[model samples]
Target: MPYARLLPPILLVFSNVFMTFAWYGHLKYRDTALPKVILASWGIAFFEYLLMVPANRLGSTVYSAPQLKGMQEVITLLVFAGFSAWYLGQPLKWNHWAGFALIVAAAWLIFLE
Candidate 1:
């Protein structure tokens, strides 16, 4: 795809990445007494929705709702993969890739002829 063609998907991908972190990263702070991470995550989530809503609206023009949502779920996994690897420094195991492959296969099925 051309650079311009990639812009919306890229934005959606980034938005989902931020969203995944905002939604799940707070789990790490569960042991803390204050547990302020939930509040912080909510703040971050606001921005995630800000980008995500527009991404869906714009992407809808080019992709049907099912396709857009499918893409969003895949993008969410992709973003979560990176977030898990980077922030948590977790290893990207082969089994994880295998699971993602299954998901990609599902996407193919969803968009199939």
Candidate 2:
């Protein structure tokens, strides 16, 4: 499918992945000194912002501000869930899936005309 509108979603997926890792990866690095952890997180966060900026800009062309925000929120939750499951070795529970489903519904509602 030639989904030109999907550019935003694709960008959002990448942005969320980078952002989630940037945010939570530092938790695992907590054994390091606080200053070092902060510095590294900042470095990673810089890249996250790079991706986020473009994602929002592109999404705005195809969706309203509220819709874009909803998409970002949903993408963030999805990215964090995956990160928790794979990197943190945590299992996804029914409750987690339920919450994600609710979030997805909210996204749909937000974008609805």
Candidate 3:
């Protein structure tokens, strides 16, 4: 397989990490100041966009638009699940797992010809 096929998902993982931080890391600093938090989140999101744009561009080489979007959604859920539990101290419930499983099932359908 071409190495390019692997680049997008890896970059997307890094991008998601930055994106999760940008969107949710601010919970820890809720008391700091709204404007400051927004500014900081935007700064972090800039890095996310950098990786995300290229990830999509590279991913498009091997994956269709819907496939790429589905992959990203699954990745975001996985990343967010971990981040919510570890960083935000919010443990996932059974319902959350069930919901995620349903999403995975949907992904399966999406990937089917």
Candidate 4:
């Protein structure tokens, strides 16, 4: 079914959102103690793993390992770009966009037969 192809990517995108926040969302709250931030991040990461496990299992049916990894990287970049700009209020510079462009190109290559 079309859902077999569509659902995994969507799930992956959501998982990456959780992961990005788990990894970087703490920067905005520097006043919080290290222990607290670590615990909170770990808590968030648990949810990320929850989504990632299912996404990968389902994605495996439609994509190769490299393709899934490449897709995840691209999704991570897109999500991080949005999160950095909106939630962190840190805009990406030209070099950052150029780097991301290169990553997208690399990901495109992963899908080629």
TM-score of each: 0.82, 0.88, 0.95, 0.97
Best of the candidates, TM-score: 4
Q: Backbone clash tally for model 3?
A: 0
lDDT of 4 by residue, 3-110 (tens): 988898999999999999999999999999999999999999999999999999999999999999999999999999999999999999999999999999999999
How do the residues 63-88 of candidate 2 rate in per-residue lDDT, one tens digit apiece? Answer: 78898899888888888888998887
- Per-residue CA lDDT of candidate 3, range 50-70, in tens? 999999998988888888888
Candidate 3 structure lDDT: 0.91
Residue-pair clashes per candidate = 0, 0, 0, 0
lDDT of each: 0.78, 0.82, 0.91, 0.96
TM-score, cand. 2 vs. native: 0.88
Lowest summed lDDT across 10 adjacent residues in model 3 is found at 1-10
Per-prediction CA RMSD (Å)? 2.7, 2.1, 1.1, 0.7
**Rank list by TM-score:** 4, 3, 2, 1
- Mind sharing the TM-score for model 3? 0.95
Off by over 4 Å in 1: 1-5, 28-30
Deviating ranges (above 4 Å) for candidate 4? none
What value of lDDT does candidate 2 attain over all alpha carbons? 0.82
Better model by TM-score: candidate 1 vs candidate 4: 4
